[model samples]
Every structure is written in C-alpha cells, then in structure tokens.
Target: MPPNSQPSPPVSPDGTTDEDAVLAVRAGKGDTAAFGALYDRYVEAVYRYVYYRVHSDTDAEDLVSDVFMRALRAIPRYEPRQAFLAWLYRIARNAVIDRARRTRIQISFEDALAHPGVDQIVEPDAGLLALADKETVRAAIARLTPLQQEVIVLRFVEGYSTSEIANLVGKREGTVRGIQFRALEMLRTLIPSREALA
Candidate 1:
C-alpha cells in the first residue's frame, strides 16, 4: 500500500477487515482526524440506518447528529470486542431509542407505510420518482418489528453481517438470523401475493 494511501475501510462488521481496532484506538486517544476518517467511512451507512428507523428526515437528521455526538462522548471508553462500526451503531441505536423514549413518541408502522417520505428521512427531494421510491422502500421496511428493523438497517442498509449484528445488538448469531428470516417473512406476507410470490 502507498504510504499516503487513504485509510482502510473499517471491518465489514461481518468479520472481514479488523483494522478498526487500530483506528478506534487512535480515535479514542483524541485523534480528531481519525474520528473524521471514521465518520467519512460510516456516515452514509449510519445515516441510512437512522433514516430507515425514524422514517422522517427531520427526525433522522437530528438523530444522526445525536448519534455522532454520543459516539464522540463514548469513544473515550470504547472497548473493541466488536468492529468499530458495530460499536458506533450500538451508540446510534441507543440514541434512536432514547429520542423516542424521551419524547414519548410513537411512530406507527401503518403511518410509515402510508407516508414513505418518512424514509426519505434525510431530504430525498431529488425528484418525484426518486422521492416516491424512497417512501416505498421505507414503508416496506416499516412492516418489520423494531428489532428486525434495526437488524435490517444494520445488515442490509448498513451492510453489517449477522455476526456483527449479534455483537451490536447483544444477540446471538442464531437470533439475528432468525430475526432476518422472520422480518423478511412479515414483509412478504404483508405484501400482495403477486409480489410475495414473485
């Protein structure tokens, strides 16, 4: 690798690269550039995960900011038993949960289905069809249970693996797999038979 090559991407959280141990160590020790690099590496995935869960650009935006803030605050004591992204995601997930709890907010799955713009949660007004598609996908994701929703966001949306999810959520790998299966089943079952079957 070139001496000036860009930093390596964090582990897949699926058990691939393990460089997060090093990057995270540096970050935890007060390395702003390392943290920035970490943010550069995972911002999109983290934002997408929060966007899918909250289903509102306004909520997701605030939540993403909170997640990063929490991560920075918690970084000083971070332990690397899991991939850094997984740890960061755990923090992000907690922020989402906290936001909902503190506000006593109840986001209805049905409402989310009816209003897909919630998934565009981060301002997806690129155009009509694109905006529509974001809503549709977000609505589909809403059919899942909250746990499944988190898993999906971490797995598919954030590209984590079952193992990484296991660490992030403090669940066993088997549980994560089961959740994935059940979430997919619920989404399929709720959709039209043609779509489900096809």
Candidate 2:
C-alpha cells in the first residue's frame, strides 16, 4: 500500500484474497514490486510443496527458483479466472514432476520410511509427539500413487479444498475426493502405531 514498498499479504482470512488477483494483474503488466509481493507470499508454500515431493533440500530449493522463474515469464498470459494460488500451485506441481522425470529420482516407500527428515513435512504447529506422528504419516504418504499423493498434500498439508485441488490437478471433484480417501486409507495402514513412534 505504500509507495515503492512491498505489497501487503496476498491472502486474506478466506485464503485467496482480491489483493492477490489485483497484484497478479499488475505483475503480469511488468510490475516488479507486484511480482515481488507474489513471490514473498508464495515462496515458502511452494518450497514446502516441492520439498515434500523431492525429499531433498537442495533439489527443492532449485525447483522453487525454477517455478518462480517460469511463473514470472508466464504471468503475462495469465487470466484471473482462478485463484492465483491455484495457478501458482499448478506451476509448482509441474516443476516437481518435471524434475522427477528429468533426474529419474527414485526412492522406494521403505526407503522413505527410513528417511530421517520426515518431520520436515509436518505443519509447524504440531507438537513433538505430533511431529513423530506426522513423520510416520508423511512417510506413508510417500508410498501412495502419484495422484493420491497430490490430492493428500493439497488437501491436508496445503489446506486446499477438494474443488480447489480438482481445478489445480485437472481432476473432477469426486475423483479428488476418491483419491484423498484412498490415500488416507493407505496412510492409516502404513503409519506406525503411536507407541511405536514414541
């Protein structure tokens, strides 16, 4: 709101706010400050999203940079029909997929179960015990099919609704819900008992 200052937060209480839409339009028109605002707003979420998929801090950092670079170039053609976050997330998703395909990074589900940084994926507010639970949960999520993993991450970790995820992933709402359901069921089966984690 101030002259030559960083733009205010793009999301309001309801999530995607009008400010996001307005700044996105300005950024599309070559407004550097506006684009910076969008970057500041989304960089962490995008990083976390990428980190969850790649399980490497270095790769996630590189891909986050790539996602923004691509977004900056593509914003000029972006329409305001969808929430800016949705569009941005789609970009992040593609970046992850592309990186996976290009590098052929493969870690089996059992390998992820042994991965030490699983707590990194848990929400920050979770308690120590909750972190353990989340670590177990995250490992289980890694075992899911790609579609199921996307739906679960978007719905639970990133807090997108079924419809929002549907739009981002180009799946029907019912299909997203189904993926989420099956993913959760798999997680329940795969996660350790609380006592085991403790």
Candidate 3:
C-alpha cells in the first residue's frame, strides 16, 4: 500500500494470473510478443481439440497452425465478452468444421482408435472401465453427435466445467449439460454392461 505501488493482476479460480485478457488487449495493439505468449499458453489445448475431432495428427497440426493464424488476424477486433480461451476455441471449432466440409471425410470409429492419442484421450474411469474397454468407450464417443462428442471431450478429457464448455461452444450451460446427459445415455446403450455381457 505505497502511493506508487500497483495492484497485482487478477487471479483465476485455478490460481493462475488471468492475463489472457490483458495479453489480448496488448496483442490487439500490435504487440507480437503478447500474442506469442497467448500462443504458448493455448496451442496444446487447440491442438487437442482439433486432433480429437479430425483424428489425424498431420491434419490437426495443420489446423492448429491455421487456427493461430486466423486468431492472430482476428484478435485485433476481439472483444472480451467471454474467456479468451473460449474465443480461441470458437475459432478452432470453426476451422475443424470448415476442413470437414472441404474434405467430406467421415471420421470413422476405427480411425479414432488408430489415432496415436487415443489412449491419452480416453483415460480410464473406474466406472466406465467396469462397463467396457477403452476401445469401446472411444467408439461410443465417436458415435455421439458432434456437439455431444465435443462436450464429452471438453468435460472429461480436457477437464472443463459445464460453464466453461458453454462459453467455449457458445451454448447455455443447461444446454451443455443436456448434451452431456444424452451423450452419456447413448454411451450406456452402446457399451453394454459387464452383467449384460455375462
């Protein structure tokens, strides 16, 4: 509390400084270093999101680069209406959709299983593991609607809350929850219980 002292930056719930907005503001003003910082912070997250959807490491790497390029071009006009990561995710989601439209490539469950990141993507949950193997779970997830798959991956694989997912996907929190609920129900049917198998 000295007269010349400045207050510390705000911290997020996870204890990290919530500097993305500040960095974004700086980047908007042509600060390349600020933008680089943001890129370092979120490139992996964007890669994971894109990789899961596309199921191709080569394509995901290309898309991540494209997403950041698009974000760099578009950040000057960025508004902080939502978390910066959420805004970035919107860009990534759109990029994936655009690629899918261009290629018209259907992502098969077999391809998802063959993806190198498959084991990392579907970490075993005790309850789910009891019901089915990792391959079964991954296949069931792939079969869900795209929105459902997105919600599931963000919630479980990426450890995002429903509120965060809503912001990322531009949906109401309740809607995200409904998507998750229905996705789970569909998964249950798709992966038969051990008792049923017996």
Q: Count the clashes in each prediction.
A: 3, 0, 0
For lDDT, candidate 1 versus 3, the one ahead is: 3
- Per-residue lDDT tens digits for candidate 2, residues 140-187, read 565677777777777667777666676677667677777877776655
* Better candidate by TM-score, 1 or 2: 2
Q: What is the TM-score of each candidate against the true structure?
A: 0.70, 0.73, 0.72
Between prediction 1 and prediction 3, which has the larger TM-score? 3
lDDT of 1 by residue, 134-198 (tens): 56557666656678889877777666667667767777777778898777655543333322223
Sorted on TM-score, best first, the list reads 2, 3, 1
Cα RMSD, each candidate: 9.5, 9.0, 8.8
* Model 1 poorest ten-residue lDDT run: 120-129
Clashing pairs in 1: 55-118, 57-121, 116-135
* Residue 112 local lDDT, model 3: 58
lDDT of 3 by residue, 166-195 (tens): 667767777887898887766665665665
Per-residue lDDT value at 123 in model 1: 20
